[model samples]
Target: MPGRGAGRVLCVSEFVRNVRLWFAPQEIREEGGTPDYRFSLANERTFLAWLRTALALIGGGFAVDQFLPDLRWAWRAGLALALLAAGVLCALRAVNHWVRTERAMRRGEDLPVSRFPALLSLVVAVVAVAMVVVVLTGWEG
Candidate 1:
């Protein structure tokens, strides 16, 4: 708290150091319970992984819909809309999932996984495949 810092708050680094001091033991135990940093980081990584997946889906969908020569207007629109929805859903789920995971980890328990991601991914995949089919079929009618 020295230097030229008048009221610089404790950033993550400071907070982490303080947490380390407060729970100095190799394993944090609280009245017959243990706090797990590994679990917290694992959950964080999972959320990050999901977000990355969402971004990739968005990028892939847009690239195909906008830049691909074979994409018809209808197909492109459908794919783009689906991808956009998926991306928004992913962002919403990421925050909620992270909070749920953090809460569970803090209490040293497991929470039920939501099935919405799998269901949404399935719907998105179907839309993507449909787009590809439409592009390939070349409007037989």
Candidate 2:
């Protein structure tokens, strides 16, 4: 029974260590070198900003789905779903971008470029135009 208890404790300890490693602050991978703390902080800030954008998009989707009036069921559903999906996609991309940037910094490589800003702008523009048309034409169902 004592051996069994010790084994259980060891398993739990290993699990906790794995969790810590998964969520720990970014580590320097380069031998005997670390990236500038300021740059790392900036990267973290950018990641947080992207997360905030994702949250806003999700909230907007909920608002459209629950509050918007004078829209057909299909229109509302489509727009809301698109927004929510985009939000989730943005969040996933943010994590990838953060990791890539951090790694590039550690390796002294050029940071990867992203076209998401342009794509997001285009999507928002298209949605805005559609909303305007629907409102101006009084196309309520």
Candidate 3:
């Protein structure tokens, strides 16, 4: 029992450390002075917006899978999976961008550049096109 609990305790401690690092890694936090509150708030807002988009995409995936039972299995699964995958990617991008932007602002560097927006847009467009094709072709169960 002690041995089993020891591993569990170690795992929990590692998880806590990882969570703390995710939010406030020392390398980034200590590298420069604190940024203005306004900029920090803006960065947080942008991060929240990305999270909202991710949530919406995830919800849309669930809706497609649940509300469109008449859709062919392959199409429904594909659409749902695509939306879910996009949501996951968006969530990850949100964190990475937030960290990079925050670090840049703190260091008085130009904000980091990224192609995530363009890539996300392209993904959405492709999904939309697929949806239109499915609807037009009457691909239903």
Strongest candidate by TM-score: 3
**Residue pairs in candidate 3 whose N, alpha carbon or C atoms collide under 3 angstroms:** none
Model 1 worst lDDT window (10 residues)? 23-32
Better of 1 and 3 by lDDT: 3
Question: Candidate 1 overall Cα lDDT vs. reference?
Answer: 0.67
| Model 1 CA lDDT for position 100 | 53
**What local lDDT does model 1 show for residue 94?**
78
What is the per-residue lDDT of model 2 for residues 21-67, given as tens digits with 9 covering 90 to 100? 34665543532357999998999999999999999989989988887
Q: For residues 51-133, could you state the per-residue lDDT of candidate 1 as single tens digits?
A: 99789878867786668656567767777777877888786677667755555565767774788777877987787677768
Candidate RMSDs in Å, in order, are 11.5, 10.5, 8.6
Model 2, residue 84: displacement in angstroms? 0.4
Query: How many clashes (backbone atoms < 3 Å, residues ≥3 apart in a chain or on different chains) does model 3 have?
Result: 0
Best by lDDT: 3
lDDT of 3 by residue, 52-99 (tens): 999999998998899877788888899999999999999977887787
What TM-score goes with each of the models?
Answer: 0.66, 0.74, 0.80
Q: What is the full ranking by lDDT, best candidate first?
A: 3, 2, 1
Q: What is the model-wide C-alpha lDDT for candidate 2?
A: 0.79
lDDT of each: 0.67, 0.79, 0.86
Residue 133 in candidate 3, Cα distance off native in Å: 0.8
Better of 1 and 2 by lDDT: 2
